[model samples]
Target: MENREESRLTSAELANLWRLYITENLMYQFKTPLIDNCQDPDIRSAIEFSRAISEHYIVSIENIFRNENYPVPTAYSENDIHPQAPALFTDVFCLHFIHQGAQLGMSKIHEMMAVAVRQDVWEVLNQGANDFKDLYQQSLQLLLTKGLYSRPAFLPPEKESRFAENKHYVSGWLGNQRPLNALEIMSIHNTIIQNGISKAILRAFAQVINDKKLRDYLEKGAETASDIMRELEDWLIMENTNVTATLDSEILPTETPPYSDKLMMMLIANVGVGSLGVYGNALSTVFRRDLGLKFMHLMKDAVQYAQEGLHLVIDKGWMEVPPQFPDINTR
Candidate 1:
């Protein structure tokens, strides 16, 4: 007979549940303001869907934690948001926020589902993943209908496929290099788009963040993001192709903050970390020495930014501790 009653939660299950509990609450905190400030009906609907899904996950995760006698972390609450505050971001930004968020959330849900061992945990996570997929599709369609979706540059088919002929194909530093390949162009193009989004987020964040030092850091981050985007755009322009800008160049002047400083820092830092991952992936895909070198430098800068952001949050007591193994040595 299986001992279902006495079964202990695996570490993976515990970690997944704990992290999602925190993440869902964070999502709720942001979505509340977005929903309140959103002017576009389509954007409002997407935000509502995302917030509803997050609420469902939070409730389910809380139930699991309670059943297992685990103390839930004090995640964000109504105190962290101000619904009546002036709109800090535009409707387009809010729409993009939901679209990007759903993509990242779905990826995480799939990862959690892959490692989940408990039957109940697996079911919950799998359901979240399916819901996010639907949400992503809906948000994407809305963006397309509004002409707000900026796709990566497309490559036309060549007369025929050909193998690399000489050493110059991969060379870039010491000698003449061949023109950029389709894959290299694609990687650089995608990196530029991500950088644009990061820059826009940080620019908006810098405007509302009150702490002088932290605001300065966010401004510096925005400058770094711009530098990266410009570099990548230059590479694409060298190939005589049009570059698609993913973020709006203008931000409304709004000093009123919709989210707490802690929440803003956390969200910006999360985006910085995600951008670093994108840079690393692009680095791996580009074979040209120049392209690879650019990605490496950009990634190094992103790492520095992310580390600084983490330290700031920790110093401010805004960082949450995740689940960890017990200190057996001390015991």
Candidate 2:
């Protein structure tokens, strides 16, 4: 027990904490202003709750690093954001953002706990998971109350047990194909939702940033998101489905920059990672041949957009180095 208490951090625990620290910092930047400008009391309450927890997590992680005699990550701070800036997103958008963030927070918590070895790390992850779960529930309930929840395409119940008796079950590029399964529809639903947010973010960033080159890149991301969303919507339309999501109008008319360009670029780069994972999962799980091809194409575009953002981040000298192993002349 004594030895365990004094042990160094495991690789998984260290990596998870590092990623969470930076992501949470970015979130804090967005939440700080949203919470201040939010008009809906219910939405504001939930955002406030989430922001408080994020602040606690940040300080807790800093203490953990200090105890380990290691340097705490220099993540975002006040300099990276202007909490008093003009409104950039509506209160409804704030609610949706918090809802989405809570979902991501839960995902991170699961990964954090799965590989956590130390008892202290487990405590933090466990508590964080429970808190995020609560936040998720709270935000979802608020969305439902406000009639803002974007549900996936509804699938009818199976009338009887069935089996795929032929190869045509997997075919999608030909005539008279099988209807989409719940999983496939759900995947499309999520992709549309993400594209909605990503496109809006790119548009917002493009409006505020002055760099012509990066603005063009941001516009490309927005266009890619829009194109993919339209294709996915067309697929859903064949099945008599329509998904209503975040609108471009949900963004305010403010031309002022709320977050630094570095933060905006980082957010886009993170979207690239999230998009690849979402598309990859859809590719593997979706049964239709056409859907698989569609994800592959969308994944290619996502990769290209992300690559551009990464190059910009590197060129701007905004990319920070993570802890690395010493070069042992690996020749």
Scored by TM-score, the top model is: 2
lDDT of 1: 0.83
Clash pairs detected, candidate 2:
none
Lowest summed lDDT across 10 adjacent residues in model 1 is found at 243-252
lDDT of each: 0.83, 0.83
| CA-RMSD of model 1 | 2.1
TM-score of each: 0.92, 0.95
Task: Tell me the lDDT of candidate 2.
Answer: 0.83
Off by over 4 Å in 2: 2-6
Candidate 1: tens digits of C-alpha lDDT, residues 1-331: 3486546678888887888888888888888977887888878998899998899899998888888888888888898887777887788877777787787788778888888877888888888888899899999999899998877666788999899887678788886667788778778876776777788889988998889999999999888888878778887787778887656554668898888898889888778766877788888899888778888988887888788889999999999987788899999
- Model 2 vs. true fold: TM: 0.95
| Predicted candidate 2 versus true structure: per-residue lDDT over 1-331, tens digit per residue | 5585557887777888888788777777767878888888888999999997788678888888899877888877889787768988888878887887787778768978999888888888888899999999999999899889988877778899888989988899989999898889988988888788888888988988768898999998888888888888888888998766656888889888888888888877876777787788788889889888898998997887777788888999988766767789984
Residue 202 Cα positional deviation in candidate 2, in Å, after optimal superposition:
1.2
